[model samples]
Target: MSNTGSASFLRELNPNRVEATKREALLENPGFGRVFTDHMVTIRYSEGRGWYDAKVVAHGPFSFDPATLVLHYAQEIFEGMKAYRLPDGGAALFRPDANARRFRNSAERLAMPALPEPLFVDSVRELVRVDREWIPRTDGSALYLRPFMIATEAVLGMKPSPDYLYCVVATPVGSYFKGGASAVTLWVSENFTRAAPGGTGDAKCGGNYAASLAAQAEAIREGCDQVVFLDAVERRWVEELGGMNVFFVFADGSIQTPPLTGTILPGITRASLITLARDLGLTVREEPYAIDQWQADAQRGKLVEAFACGTAAVVTPIGKVKGRTHEFTIGDGNLGLVTARLKSALLDIQNGRAPDHYGWLDRLF
Candidate 1:
């Protein structure tokens, strides 16, 4: 499955099939990532041919050799974003090009072939176009898109694969908060680190999440909603949550988030929140926020609100920070005014209720 750069070819699935009732039932709940849409997009890449064989096919499994490079060396990268159906029946993607750019960056970082921007954008557009109805119109619901690339060469010597595969799959998702937006508890993981200095933390890859799952399981057992990781070097400065970026609101009506210290995932929603905060006339700072500093401020009444931001949850308030022997509760253990306001603003822009001042919305249809 190699492609010549100038060839215009896409193999369409002959069956073109879907189970209607089953899909409907799944969409009724559409719990995140459990069920997939009817169709998926795929394109192949090789050392000599680049990316080719772009096509939309029925969602199904792939047959891969046991010696596939990705199976051994894990030369893979992925991204997460969403598409929303607006009131007018049209669909929109929140800064999809930004995701595309980040996908390319991740590929470069992992020594995988960069899927051309046009192909990447077109692949997403085609998927959304075919599966537009799968995009939920309910509030706080969307069609979650997962785009990924895997090295597919059938040798496992650890060198970059001569062949690669890039794919996009989508799943309808309901509100990340099962009931409603509520304050969450976080466990400080002083023993385990999600990413180390000069690591793949900045990339949207699966290994990082896989590495954090153990610590996340421990946090859950400890009655915390999420795990907060510290810098691997000193285990002092706060990096981020297991899957999201952290922010702090101070008594002085200012905001602070851990700076992008090369060991943190520069979340797309995190950057947008910073921009929106500035637009809302709030003082915002990005620096090394230490765990000690967070506790000290909570005691001094300076840390008023805390939250985590990601594409999945949008924004969630952090009600309490619990460590092995210490616990600090923030702002009555409820969603603060600033946290609620920011979440609403971002959601409004996402749902097409508020103006997209930053030109973040990209219409898919």
Candidate 2:
């Protein structure tokens, strides 16, 4: 799938044949990534034919050859974002354009065909419109959208596949953390590093997450909720968690997050919070923070709070840090004021409870 050009057409719509009725039950307790909607969008790409055969079909299984290149080489990438059910009984997407750009970046990094930005957003829009009812009405709940592309060419000898498939699937989710917006514990992993210099750390791909699983399992064993990784070179500077970006709040009323040095995921939610924090009269800084500094600051009461941000988790407070050598609690081991305020501000904008001062919400209805 080498053709990297813009193409447009009407997608063939094939709605779900069955009428959905378990929505209330699912919405009541739709845990993260468990309950999916009834329809999905798909688009195909070939070396000769740019991008074609777009369709909105019923959610079902797909058949593929055992020798498919994606099965072996893992030439695939994905993006995670959400469609929020607004206060006015409508639907909106939060910074989907940013997700579309990141999707293209991931595609370029993985040697896959680049789906046009318009095409990408349009595909998601169509899917969400068809399954708008799947958007959970519960506060702090949304329809999680996953857009991905995979290498489909059967003849594979460690080369880019000539055929590609791009798809979008959505699921109604409540909270990524177990106990709703409660604080969480983190396990600092000194043994495993998520990405190295000149690696695929910045790209949103499957392999990065797969590589973090071992460390994540270790965190679970340590009775922690998530794992934090340090830089791969010196192994001192704090990088990020398995799937979320980290932030720190000082007792002097200031904020700092690790700068994006082509080694961090550059989370959309992270960027949004930076703006929102500034609007709320808080100083936000993007800088490299060391693990030892975090521990020292917390111990001395200089660092009052810490948190992680991502599309799935949104804004989650980091209450405690359990490292192999050291362990400490941030503030009172509870959700801090800055963390709660930032979460509420972002959620208010997303759920239409507050004005979208930055024009981040893209209303679909």
Task: Extract clashing residue pairs from model 2.
Answer: 1-162
Clashes (N, CA, C under 3 Å) per candidate: 0, 1
2-105 per-residue lDDT for model 1 (tens digits): 23222343647537555667667777888888878878998888787667677888889999999998988889999899998877889898998889889988
> How many clashing residue pairs are found in candidate 1?
0
- The deviation in Å at residue 214 for candidate 2 is 0.2
Cα error of candidate 2 at position 153, Å: 0.8
Residue 355, model 2, lDDT: 92
lDDT of 2 by residue, 1-365 (tens): 12343344345554543355667777888899977888889899888778888888878888999999999999999999999998889999999989999999998989887888888888888889988988999878999999999999886599999999999999999889998778899999989999997899999999999999999999999999999999999999999999999999999999999999988998999999999999889999999999999999999999999999999999999999998886999999888999999999999999889999888998999
Q: Specify the poorest-scoring 10-residue window by lDDT in model 1.
A: 1-10
Query: After superposition on all CA atoms, what RMSD does each candidate show versus the true structure?
Result: 2.1, 2.0
- The segments of candidate 1 whose C-alpha lies over 4 angstroms from its true place after superposition are 1-16, 19-22
Error of 2 at 166 (Å): 0.2
